[model samples]
Target: MKFMHISDLHLGKRVNEFSMLEDQKDILRKILKIADEEKPQALLIAGDVYDKSIPTVEAIQLFDDFLCELSKRKVQTFIISGNHDSAERMAFGGRLMKESGVYVAPVYAGKTQAVVLEDEWGSINIYLLPFVKPANVKRFFEDEQIENYTDAIRVAVEQMKLNTDERNVLVTHQFVTGAKRSESEDISVGGTDNVDASVFDEFDYVALGHIHGPQKIGRETVRYCGTPLKYSFSEIHHKKSVTIVEMKEKGNVEISTKELAPLRDWCEMKGTYMELTEKAYYENLDQDSYMHITLIDEEDIPEAVRKLQVIYPNLMKLDYDNQRTRGKAAFLEAAEVEEKTPFDIFEELYEKQNNQEMNEEQKKLIHDLVEKIWEGGH
Candidate 1:
């Protein structure tokens, strides 16, 4: 059985206050095209179908169109809710949709539901474990000791009673231990939300989501498909793709990735203000691409971002790496006055305020005040 694994769609997401709807539409179409060419039996969307719990109308319609087309093609689909998704909303018409070969995992309570599909070899049981927490698991398994995210997920998987004799696939949205995170993902502090990869040892393949970078965890069978488009400047260099998995039988699987091309790529550019503005330098580049530019010029450019927007319409961020900025850091570090005596400190302050050393009369007055304050134990 062949299927495509993708996650973190984050539809209707906006980067730097710029809407990504058009880019999302373009990428979804590309995914459809890949689906057509690959002709996979199913497409597995692990989680994060929308950018927010309450998505915009356009986001809903866009996802609807994608699903409608898949239904038309008679392709099966499996989806689960991520941290950013409202499970109740995502599962609103899940029962009805399942009748048409679309399976959406409901908000997990106690038992995780598995959708069984059969191939020539045998039946492949696909388990859907949506984003879970300790509290969610504790409510159902009152007797189980679910202390953290790992314990919660471990207890939930144990209740599934998975049969090792048959091929089983697990689809979940989680922060698997050791998986690298991108700036775009909302991660918890101190790795408190991490789940161990060993918990999924029984499954033939584990499809994961949540982390924005596509990568394998522990073994080749467990993987995160990543986002289709870069959502932050930190992900400027990511080569986004959809994972393709082909399972012939129990413990026999092949995995590959299909690259996705966005309407405009996310990139970072560094140069002097003059160089960046020169027609010769930027004339051939893709002005529509999202950009994070760093200026290396010493002098500040007035309305730099506004002016750059004329040539690069999608410039998202601007920063300076010039001498003045560098000197400011050095000056701050060198100006530490903790070791100086109060009189010395006052003298430096007087010099700065008056552009000269303190006069004799002023010095006498300050010395008298300091002596009086010291004598009084202040």
Candidate 2:
């Protein structure tokens, strides 16, 4: 059986303070187009189908439409909730949706839930482990104390182990080992909400999520499918992709990845004003690509970005090296300089406002006035 694996669609997400509903719709449509061309038997969405716990009405409709499309094509879909998803909301009507070949696992009731799919070759037992904090799992267990990611994941994995299916696949969302995080990802309290890669021991293959970069954890059997687009400026260099796993039989599996082209690339460039002005410097740059330009000139650049945007119109930021231009001595000698205190600055401005300089007697009179005010005699 061949399965297309994707994650972190983050539908209803806003990018650059702009509504990303259209971008999301275009990407999902493209994904379904690819799936139709490839004709995969099953589709595995690891986690974080929506960008927020409370998704917008438009987001809900987008997902509902996508699920209906997959159902129409007789494609089996397995989805699990992530940190950003509301468990109860995702699981709503899940039982009814399962009849249409869609499996939504939002909460871990007592054990891990597996959607069994069979083809001409054999049967594949795919387990969905939704995102859960260690405290929540500990509360669920009520007896044993779960301290960290490893402990909580162990509970779910142990439940999955009960099923002795030959070909088993685990779909999960967590901060797994060897995966890189995007800036947009929510950090747990003190970064303590992470699971080690060792927690998934017995599964034949693991499709992971939460991290925005696709990577293998300790072994090739466990991998993150990553997000479909660059969610943050920190993820500017990310090349998003979806994984396709073809299971032959038992332990033998072939995993292939296909890149999902983003709407545009995010780039960060740094150079002196003179260099940036040269035609050859940015000749290869895509004019429509989003960019952050850092000007390393001796002074503030007034028209640097304005000029560059003539070449690269989609420039988002322009920073000048003004601090470095002042030199280290300026900062180091600050204490030694004749700097005015707040009161002194205020007095000087006041004198300027009155269009006259304050004599020693006048200064002394102002000081007396301030003292009288301090004494509540205003």
Candidate 3:
């Protein structure tokens, strides 16, 4: 059985105030083209279909179009909600949609539902386990001892009563241990939300989401197929792609990836102010690509961002890294401050603030105020 594993669509996302709608549409078209050629038996979307719990009308329409196209192609789909999704919203019309080969996992209610599919070899039990928390598990299985995320997932899987003899695939959205995170991902405060990879030993293939970097956790079978587009500057280095899995039989699987080409690539450019704005440098680059530029010129340039935007229309961020900006360490020099008296420090601050030395009259006034305060304290 061949299937495409993808996740974290974040359809309505905006990167640095630039709407990704057009880029998302272009990428989804590319995905559809791939689907047409591969003709996979099913497509697995692990989670995070939208950027927010309450997706915009355009986001809903875009997703609807994608699903409609997949249905038209007779391609079966399996999807689950992520932390950013509203379970009730995602689950709406799920039963009706399942009739058309699109299966959407409802809000996790302690028990996981498995959608069984068949090929020439045998039956493939596709389990839809949406994002879950310890509190959610504890609500359903109050008697069970579920202290953490790992325990919660373990209990949920156990409830599925999976059969090891048959080929089983689990679709989950979670923060699995050993998975790297990107800036766009909503990470837990600590390791409290992490689930051990070993907990999914029973499944033949585990399609994961929630982390934006495509990577395997413990084994090849357990994987996170990252976001198709770069959602943050931190993900500038990621070569976004969709994971394709081919399952021959139980314990026999092959995984491969196909690159996703976005309308405008996310990138970082660093150089002096003049070097960046020069026609020679700017002409060769994709001016429309989302960019984070670092100007290393010692002197601040007037309207630097505005000038850069004239050449690189999609400049998202502009920052300076010259000596002036980088001169100050985050911490103050304690010894230098310690050497000065309170009055001396105050006088230095007054000069810096006024951009001039205190006149004799102002100096006497400050001295009198300081003396009065000192006498009162003594």
For residues 1-378, write the lDDT of model 3, one tens digit per residue: 999999999999877789998898888999999898888999999999998789999999999999999999999999999988887899999999988999999888877878988987799999999898899889999999999999999999999998889999999999998888877777565677999988899999999989998999888999999999998999988999989999997778999999998899977999998898888888898888999999888888899888889888899999988766665532246556668777787788676433369999988998999999999999
lDDT of 1 at 125: 93
Residue 320 in candidate 1, Cα distance off native in Å: 1.0
Task: Point out where model 2 deviates above 4 Å.
Answer: 189-191, 272-283, 302-313, 322-378
C-alpha lDDT values of all predictions: 0.90, 0.80, 0.89
- For candidate 2, give the lDDT of residue 308: 79
List the candidate numbers ranked by TM-score, top first: 3, 1, 2
Q: For candidate 3, list the clashing residue pairs, or say none.
A: none
Q: What does candidate 3 score on TM? A: 0.87
In candidate 1, clashing pairs total 0
Arrange candidates by lDDT, descending: 1, 3, 2
lDDT assessment of candidate 2: 0.80
Model 2, 38-62: lDDT tens per residue?
8899998988889888889999999
